[model samples]
Target: MSKIALFGASGTIGSRVRREALDRGHQVTAVVRDPRKITEEHPALTVVTGEVLDAASVAAVAEGHDVVVSAVGGGDGPGHQATIKPAAEVLVEGLRSLGTDAPRLIAVGGAGSLRTPDGAQVWDADGLPEFVLQIMHAHGDALDFYRTVGDVRWTCLSPAAQIEPGERTGRYRTAVDDLIVGADGQSRISAEDYAVALVDEIEDPRHVGERFTVGD
Candidate 1:
């Protein structure tokens, strides 16, 4: 089983990922900002408290873990701080300090960057709300910084056009360069199934240096 040093374990996506990891029998060192904030506990899980923007602190938590998964979000307040450019910089450098070949990193990226019909990004689509485009640009900027650095073993997962809580059917389409949409034209994917995709990628390496999106 893969030994994972998980960041953002307290959030929605992270929580599901954590449960899925446990179900798969992998050991998880849950790196959170506050260990006491955890509402549930698992024997296979270990909690470490610290900030994600501190490379040294993050590296310390990363020691002995095979891979690192970050389910960081950029919403209002605390989420915004975590999703801002600084968070990406911190993680990029932190992963680098893990010594060139240690701890493969997987980041939770936004779906805004995905392509839409006629070749424009989803966020750039016609009549898209201004606020939505704003955050999408923010995530694009974060990932842009990541491209300038090397020595970081990393890949990003962009879920289906829409991601929310639902059942885990383990049934979803995978794509390398484009977002997957159902026949009806809406792209929605369950968080549980997304967890399945993430953990499966953790177990078997694929789509390195490439971006893949999943949907129903």
Candidate 2:
């Protein structure tokens, strides 16, 4: 089982990812701003106070872990500026300080940059709210930053156009750089199944140094 250091464990996607990781027998250290926010007790889970925006904090918690998973920007969390691109920059900087002892980085990304079947990007669609457009651009900026880093082994997983807290069907389709639309002409996946896909990636390590998306 992998030893994972998880950031943003109190958020929607992060909580589900934490549960999925623990259910699969992997050890998880849930690093959050306030430790008391995580009340779930598990044999394989450890909650600790941390600041994801600080590189020193990232390095301190990231040491000795097999993989560092950041669920920031995956769900409707606050602090749009702090959660997306800046978090990505600090995470890489912190991991870089560890030298060869650093674990792989898996970060939650946005679907805005993914190309649609009709030759337009998700964010390019009409009538998106200002907040959503901001988050999408932030994720896109973070992805651009990730693409320039070659020393640190990093992977970004962008969720579908529509993702919410739903049942975990344990089944989904994957794509790289392109949006995954189902036969129903919609792009969506339950956050639980997205957690499954993430943990599966943690175990298998297939999309390293690149970004991939998931849909139901």
Candidate 3:
């Protein structure tokens, strides 16, 4: 089984990914600021208390793993927003310091930077809300940073326009550089299905060094 070091394990997406990974027989180290926040327990799971922004702490926990999945989210407050870039920067640096290239990194990204049918960015759509604009800008910045860093094998997986807790059908469509819309003209995917896709990718590496989107 592959060893995975997951940051932000207490978050929504991270927790789902942790469960999916463990269910697939992989060993998972859930890194979070508060250990009590994670309620689920599995034989293959180990919870560790740490900060993702701290390079030293990240490096310590990420030292020996087959893959690293970062599901950290941008906070609600204005000042706390724009966290993805900083967290990604520290994660890359921390993984590099380990002096090994075994573990590949996968980052859960946002859909704002994704392209529409007319080749326009979703974030740039007309009449977009101000709060959404802020988060999108940060996500765009984080994706941009990933594009420039070549020393590590990283993949940014952006979900559909709407993601929430739902059933795991294990059925979805994948696309690159553009948003995926269903037959109903809606762009969305269940969180469980997204986790399935992520774990599938973790087991079988594809779309490496690039960004891909998923939808139902």
- Which candidate comes out best when scored by TM-score? 2
- Candidate 2 — which pairs collide? none
C-alpha RMSD values across all candidates: 1.9, 1.3, 1.3
Estimate the overall C-alpha local distance difference test score of candidate 2: 0.93
Model 1 segments more than 4 A misplaced: 74-82
Per-residue alpha-carbon lDDT of model 2 for 72-120, expressed as tens digits? 7544544574578889999999999999889999999989999999989
The TM-score that candidate 1 achieves is: 0.92
TM per candidate comes to 0.92, 0.97, 0.96
* lDDT tens digits, residue span 21-118, model 1: 99999999888888886767788988889678888987888777889888876454324633656777887777778785578888777778888755
* CA displacement after TM-score superposition, residue 134 of candidate 1 (Å): 2.0
Candidate 3 lDDT, tens digit per residue, 1-216? Answer: 899999988887898899899899999999989999988878899999878898899888888888989999746557544577898898888877876564789999999999988898888888977877887787788889899978888899999988988999999999998999888988999989999999999989998899999999
Better of 2 and 3 by TM-score: 2
Q: How big is the positional error of residue 9 in model 2, measured in Å on the Cα after superposition?
A: 0.5
Q: Model 2 reaches what TM-score against the true structure? A: 0.97
Q: Give the alpha-carbon lDDT of every model.
A: 0.80, 0.93, 0.88
User: Candidate 1, clashing residue pairs?
Assistant: none
* Weakest 10 consecutive residues of candidate 3 by summed lDDT: 74-83
